[model samples]
Target: MSLDPAAVRAAFAAAVNMDAAELEEWLETPESLSVGQKKDGALESVGHAAGRRLVTLLRSDPGALDEDAYRLMRKAVGFIRRHRAQEPANMVTSRWRYALMNWGHDPLK
Candidate 1:
């Protein structure tokens, strides 16, 4: 099924209660953007890596991510990144923040 990028971005924003622009900025930095590589006229290596990391994190808990939740998160990250010109930092950061929160961690703390 095809996923809508805007919808994915909006869902991410709502889930994390963050400013989407802030996340977009963070995603374009040298660090994050640098991880991506050209592939089939698209830059998805970085996003795929990010999604896999999230999946791994959830999987490690053994019961954290059911099939549907895992699939949706993967789809959201992949679809949004694929459809955007500039990377979606807001969506990326929302995922990162969510992961950190899941582990009782904090970037600011």
Candidate 2:
């Protein structure tokens, strides 16, 4: 993703409304553990892993950010946007919401 750093930052901020504290807390939940794809019988889902990385990214100093960091942010923004568009009827407890939440997006918010 060769996105402009500023645009990626803005889009990411818009997509992931959950702050680091909120996302950190959410990531520890069983619901977070229960969703997303686990390729090749992996223990953790892709979104869950991304959430962990997102935590680190959220906590890092803005001045220290790099292209790789922006790339992850841009990718996350895309995932959140695409997933959000597929809003399920009962989002309160839907797996779709849970998956997005794992990626640091709380659709209900």
Candidate 3:
């Protein structure tokens, strides 16, 4: 089962600070492409895929979001929250920063 939608919404609001256009542009960058685990030699990492979903989620109406969308949101929220605590000394160009950005969060913001 997915997380509580209300809790997900609250955590999501706090975690996902980037807009759709901004996230879309970020996902196109080499930095965005460079980090995260890519299973079975797949081109895109899980975080990259989640960022794409966040972009879509940002654009979608809150009332119409499906459970799967909520699940994705919950996952992104958890990932963002956990990784945010592991911030590197070099926030600007660190792989940690890149990984978080891939999940639609710019800690620098």
Q: How close is candidate 2 to the true structure, as a TM-score?
A: 0.94
What lDDT does the true structure give each of the candidates? 0.44, 0.91, 0.89
Model number with the top TM-score: 2
Clashing pairs in 3: none
Best by lDDT: 2
Backbone clashes in model 3: 0
Candidate structures ordered by TM-score, highest first: 2, 3, 1
Q: Give one digit per residue, the lDDT tens place, for model 2 in 9-67.
A: 89998898888889999999999999999989999999999999899999999879998
Error of 2 at 68 (Å): 1.5
Which residue pairs in candidate 1 collide? 23-89, 23-90, 24-89, 24-90
lDDT of 3 by residue, 1-109 (tens): 4458888889888888999999999999998999999999899998998888888989999988889988888889889889988877899989999999888889989
Model 1 / residue 28 / CA error / Å: 2.6
* Candidate ranking (lDDT, best to worst): 2, 3, 1
> Looking at model 1, which ten-residue stretch has the lowest summed lDDT?
98-107
**Total clashing residue pairs per candidate?**
4, 0, 0
Better of 1 and 3 by lDDT: 3
Q: Give the lDDT of residue 81 in candidate 1.
A: 40
Stronger candidate by lDDT (1 vs 2): 2
> The CA-based lDDT of model 3 is what?
0.89
Worst lDDT 10-window in candidate 2? 1-10
